[model samples]
Target chain A: MNINWGFIVSSLPLYEKAAWLTLKLALWGISASLIIGLVCSVVLYYRIKVLERLVRAYIELSRNTPLLIQLFFLYYGFTKIGITMSENTCAIIGLAFLGGSYMAEAFRGGLESVSKAQIESGLSIGLSNMQMIRYVILPQAFSVSIPPLGANCIFLLKETSIVGAIAIPDLMQVTQDLIGIYYQTFEALFMLVVAYMILLLPVSVALTWLERKVRYAEFGN
Target chain B: MLNSGISVLVEGINLQRLLAGLFVTARIALISIVIGSVLGIMLGLIRTSKSKVVRFICRFYLEVFRIIPILVWMFIVYFGVTNMFNIHLSGELVALIIFSLWGAAEMSDIVRGAIESLPKHQIESGRALGLSFWGLYRYILIPQAIRRLLPGAINLSTRMVKTTSLVVMIGVIDVVKVGQQIIERSILKTPTASFWIYGLIFILYFIVCYPLAKLSKILETKWES
Candidate 1:
C-alpha cells in the first residue's frame, strides 16, 4: 500500500474539527457525570429506605446493560416524548447519563472506604454531619477514588465514539463521514485511530502520574 | 409518532425473519466465544511469560485493545481490510474476525489474572514432584486454572453477545439492524416502533446477559468457602 500523503494531509482539517468536538463531548460529559454522580452517590449513602431502593434499582439497571443500547433508548425515547435536542446535545446527554451511573458507583465505593472513626472523632468535637463530611470525609475519599475515577474517565472518552451512531459529528463520525464522501476509507480511518491516540494517551499518562502522586501521599513516611 | 410495538408488529417483522436474526447473532457469538477462548488462554500464557520482549508485546496488545473502542476497531477492519486486500468476504465473516481478535485480547487478561492469583507454592510444588514440565502444566496447573477461568469466561461470553450489535453497523442484519430496518419502513415510520423495538432489543440483550451474571455470582459464592 503506497502512502497517500495528500489524502491524509487534506483530511487534517476534518480530523482537527472532529477532535475538538470529541473533546467537547468528553469534557462536558465528564463534568455532568460529576454532578449527577455526587447526588446519586449521596442518595445511595444517606437516603431513607424508599429512596435507597430507587437508587439501587437505577444503578444496577444502568451498570448491567450496554452503553450502546442506552444511547439508542435516549435517542429514540426522548424524541418520542416530545423532547428533541440537537444531535450533539443528545449525544452529550446520553453519555453523561450512561457514564454517570459508573461514576456514582465509583463515588459510593470511595465513600465506603472512608474510616468511620474519623467521622465519630469529628462529632465528638461538635461537628455537624455536613461539617464532618465537608471537613473530614471528602479529603480522604478523594485519594482512594483516584485510580478507579481515572479509569472511569478513560472509559468515558472511549464511550463518546458511540455518538457517531446518532450523527453527532464527533471524532469517529467525522472519520466515517470523510470516508463516506472521499472513497478513501482506510487512510482517513487510520488517521482517526492516530487522532484518538493523541487525545487519549496523554490523559492516560497524566492519570498514571496522578495515581502515583496519591499513592505516595498515602504512604509517605 | 413511532409506535413502540413494531418489533412484533403483526406485520412489521415476520416470525421467520426475527427468528433468523436471533439465530444468526447467537451463532456468531458462539463461534467468537469458542475461538476467542482458545486463542485468549494461549496468548495469556505468552503474556505472563518471563521473557521481557514477549511480555511487552502482550502488554501492548492488551493496552491498545483496552483504550480503543470496539466499534471503531470494527470500522477500521470492515473498511480497511476489505479494500486493502481486495477480499470479497461477507459481513458476518468480517465481524467474526474482528470480534474474536478483541475477545482474545480481553480474555487473555482474565486468564493472566486467574493464573497469578494462585499461590506460588503450586508451581514450585509441581516442580518438586519430579513431573515433567508438560505433565505439570497439563494436570496440575491447568486444572486449577480452569476452575478460576470459568466465571470470567462466562462473563466474556455475554459480552460477546451484547457486542455483536456492532456488526449491525457493518450491515449484518443482527437484532438491532433488524429493528432499525423495521422502523425505517412504512408501518414503523413513526417513533413508537423504534422505542418498543429498541425496548425489546434491550430485553433480549438483558435476558442473554442476566443468566451468565447470576451463574457467575453463584460460582463466586461456591468458590468463596
Candidate 2:
C-alpha cells in the first residue's frame, strides 16, 4: 500500500510534543541517575564492609529487575502503599532511579580503573578522598569511563521508551493511541519508527561526539 | 476480596503460564544471542576486513543498532512489515526476529571491540610461529577473547531479558502485561488489589533478573583475577 505522507505530516505536532516529553523525561531521568549513581557508586566503592555489602545488594536488585516491572510497581503497586505519583512522573522517576544504579557501577568501574598508584599520588599531594575524586581520579578516569558512560546514556534514553507502556504518552505511547484512533497500524507504526529514529539517532550521535571530545581532553590532544 | 484477588493473581501464574513466559523469553534470548553471535562474528570479521566495501557495511550495521531503539525494530517487524507482507507471525515470533536483528548488531560490536583490544603481540607472535589462520584463531585468539567476551555478553543477556518487557505493549502477555491485566481487573473488583498485583510482578522480575546481574559482576572479577 502506498503511504499517506499527509497523514504522517499531520501528526508532526503531536510527535513534537511527544518528543519533548521524551526529552524532558530523559533530562530528569539522567540527572537523577547521575546524582544517584555517582553517590551510590562512591558509597559502594569506599564504604566499609557491611555498608559496602548493602550497596552491592542495592545495585544488584536495581540491575536485575526489569525496569518495566519497576514502573508497574511504582504505578500500580505503590499507589496503594500511599506512594503515588502521576504515571508520567512515576515513569520518569522510576527510569531515573533505576538508571542511577547502573550509572553508579559505570562510575565505579571508571573510578576503580584509577589505579592505587594514582590515589596514593593524590594523597601525597595533600588532597582528601573527595578532593582526590574530584581532582585526580575523575579527571584521569574520564577517558576510560567516557565510552561506557556515553553508551549507558544512550541505553538509558532508549530504555525511557518503556514509560509509554505506563501510558505516559511518550513517542511510543502516542503512536499506540494514534493507532487506536486511526486504525491504520502500519502507518502509525511507520511514523513511530521514523519518529524514534529522528529523535534518538541524533542524541546517540551527540553522545558519541561528546565522548570523543572528552577523549581528546583526557589526552590533552 | 483480598483472598480472591490473591487467588486470581496467583492463578495467572503457574507452571504453564510462568513456564511459557519464561520459555518464550529464554528462547527468544538464546536464539537472538546464538544467531546474533553468528552474524556478529561475520560483521566483526568484516571490521578487520581489508575490503573497503566490507568495512563500510560493517560500520553501517553497527551504527544502526547503536543508534536505533530496540522498539523500532519491534515496530518495523511486528507492526510495519508483517501485515503488509501478509505474514502470519505471532508477537513472540516478531519479538524474536527483532531481538536477533538487534542482538546481531550489538554482538558484532562487542566481538570487534574484544578482538581489537587483544595484545597486538599475540597476533604477531602467532604469525611468527608459522601458525595457520585457524591455528592462530583457535589457539592464541579465542582464549584471550573469551574472558573479555563473557562479561559483556552476560550483561547483554540481562538487557535482552529486561527488554522483553517491551513485548507487553505488543500483546505478548509478559510479566508486565499480566500485571496490567491484574491491575485493570483489580480496579473493577477492588481498588487496593492493584498494589499487590504490581508488587508481585516486581518480585517475579527481580527473582528472574537479579542473579544475572550478580553473575556478571562475578565474571568481571574472575576475569580480572
Candidate 3:
C-alpha cells in the first residue's frame, strides 16, 4: 500500500484553517451550552414546577435524538420556512443544544454535590437566595462540573464533524474535498485523524489536571 | 391555509416506506451491538491481561475510537478504503463494521471499568481455591461484572441505535435517509412537508430509543437495589 506523504504535506495549510474553524465552532458551542446548562441547573435547583418539566423534556429530547437529525431539522427545515442561516450558524446552534442537555445533567450533579451545610452557612451569613447561589453554590458547582464540562466540549468538537454533511467547510469537509481531488484517501484521512488527536488530547489532559486541582482545593490541601 | 399545508404534507407521507426504513435501522443496530459486544469482551479481557503489549494495544484501540468522530470512521471505510483496496463492500456492510468497531471501543471501556471496580479479594480467593484463569473469570469475575455491565451495555445499545442514523449519511438509506428523500420529493408540493417528514422521523427514533433508555435506567436501579 503506497501512502502519499507528499500530498498531506502540501495540504497542511488547508487542514490548519479547517482545524481553526473546528476549534472556533467548538468554543462557541461549548460557551453557549455552558451558559444554558448553568441557567437550567439553577432553575432546576430552585424547583420551579412548570419550567422544570419543560427543561426536562428539552433535555430528554436532545439527549435521546441523533444530533445529526437535529442539525438537519434546523438547517433544512428552517430553509423550507424561508428562515435561512449559514451552515456554520445552524451547526453551532445544533451542537449547543445537544451539549446543553448533557451539560445540564453534569451541572445538576455538581450542584447536588455541594453540601447542604455550605448553603446553610451562606444563609447564616445573612445572604439572600440569589447571593447564596452566586457566592457559594455556583463556585463549588463550577469546579465540580468542570471535568464533565470538558468532556462535553470534547464531544462537541467531535460532533462538529457532522456539520460537514451539510457542506460546512470544517475539517471533515475539507478532508473529503482533498480526498476527491487527490484520491489520497488513506493519507488524507490519517492526517485528519492525527490532526483531531492533536487538537483534542491537550484539552483532555488540561481537564484532568484542572479536575485534580479542584479536588485538592476542595479538600483545603 | 394552515389546514391546507397540513393536509398537503400528510397526503405525501408514506407509512410503509418509513417503517421499512426503521426496520433497516433496527437491524443494523442489533447486529452492530452483537458484534460490538463480542469484540468488546475480547478487548476488555486483553486490557486486563498481564501482557503489557496486549494492554497497550487495547488501550490504544479504545482511546483512538473514543477520540475520533464516528462519521470519520464511516467515511474511511466507505470512501477511503474502497478507493485503495479495489474491494467493493455494500454501504450497509461498511456501516455495520464501522458501528461495531465504535461500539467495541466503548464496550471495552465499560467492561474494563466493571471488572476493575470489583473487589480484589474475590479474585484472590478464587485463585487461592485453585481455579484456573478461565475458571476464575467464569465463576467469580464475570458474574459480578455482568450486573454492572448490563446497564452500561444497554445504554451503549441505545447510543448505537441513535448513532446508526449517521449511516444514512454514507448512503445506507435508513430512516433519516428515507425522511430526507420523502422531504425532497414533497418539498415542491408543500414546503411544510420537510418539517413534518423530519418531525415524524425524529419521533420514530424517540419511540425506539426512549424505551431502551428507560430499560437501562430500570436495570441500573434494580442492580443497585
Model number with the top lDDT? 3
User: Least lDDT summed over 10 consecutive residues: which range in candidate 3 chain A?
Assistant: A212-221
Best by DockQ: 3
Q: List the residue pairs that clash in candidate 3.
A: none
Q: List the residue pairs that clash in candidate 2.
A: none
Docking quality (DockQ) for each candidate: 0.52, 0.65, 0.66
Please tell me which model should have the higher TM-score, number 2 or number 3.
3
Work out candidate 3's RMSD over C-alphas.
2.7
TM-score of chain B of each: 0.90, 0.86, 0.92
- In CAPRI terms, model 1 is classed as medium
Candidate 3 residues B195-223, lDDT tens each?
67777777878888888888998989999
Error of 2 at A119 (Å): 3.3
Deviating ranges (above 4 Å) for candidate 1? A115-136, A217-221, B1-8, B12-16, B126-140, B143-149, B187-191, B221-225
* Residue B34's lDDT in candidate 2: 83
User: Given the true complex, what DockQ would model 1 score?
Assistant: 0.52
lDDT of 3 by residue, A67-121 (tens): 8888888887767667798998998899889999889989998898888888888
Q: Estimate each model's TM-score.
A: 0.89, 0.89, 0.91
lDDT comparing candidate 2 with the true structure: 0.77
